[model samples]
Target: MEPGAETLYAYANRRRREITEGVNGGSGRIVPVTIAAGTFPFPIDATTRNAIASAATATTLAGGDAYTVPSWLLPTGRFITLDATAIVVVALAISVAFQAVFSAQAAAFAGIADGSVTTHEAVDAILGS
Candidate 1:
């Protein structure tokens, strides 16, 4: 099994539970689950790919009313549709760096403000801090 398969399975199971339990005011509609197995490399063996696709379709048909997982939960589809994966990754990296930098700055400022160190001393402490 692939790394994402478990997550997908859990997502489907959660949706199944939600549908059966009537989380949305007792709708009582059976939600269908579709699990499409996809290989890592593009253009996989035709037969296997077709079989997986067929299984996914059959699963959808077997369950009366189909309810798909939200876009964010589907890795490939969500990333491709939004085209924001790179942007999000960059943003998160910058955010983490900024937090680290600011935290160090704050620590230096605190030391200076509390009279634990002079401006020059704080600058040296900050460099070493």
Candidate 2:
């Protein structure tokens, strides 16, 4: 039988978790966050996700203006010293990449529900797995 909506949604949730945890199929996606202090390895994990969301919100509220984003923490427990413009650029890119992957997963789930997708391979293709 074809996969049910519950099963497909579960798979999609697992894919999102995998992407956030940066493990299993989601390994090796390191974002090199460069700031005035230096470059740091930003893992695709919960903390980085929160940071991106916060930064994105700040950028939006600032209306694309430049200023100081003070004391942004790095993975190494060190803080980055950078102005708003540079961090906004990095945040925009990171958010876009994540949004694309998640949107693909959502599309896969929707396609499966609508009978447009019938195979595991098709779902994987849409989800980039």
User: Which candidate's TM-score is highest?
Assistant: 2
What is the clash tally of candidate 1? Answer: 0
Residues 13-129 of candidate 2 have per-residue lDDT tens digits of 776767656665444245776655666766666566677667767776777665566776666777776566666666765666667777888798889889887776677778774
TM-score of structure candidate 2: 0.61
User: Quick one: best lDDT, which candidate?
Assistant: 2
TM-score for each predicted model, relative to the true structure: 0.30, 0.61
Clashes of each: 0, 0
Clashing pairs in 2: none
Q: lDDT per prediction? A: 0.35, 0.69
Tens-digit lDDT track for model 1 on 31-127?
1222233222111122323433443454456562342323222212332111133223322333343344445555655655565545443344453
- What's the CA RMSD of model 2 in angstroms? 4.6
Show model 2 residue runs off by greater than 4 Å.
24-44, 52-81
Q: Which stretches of candidate 1 lie over 4 Å from their true place?
A: 1-83, 119-121, 124-129
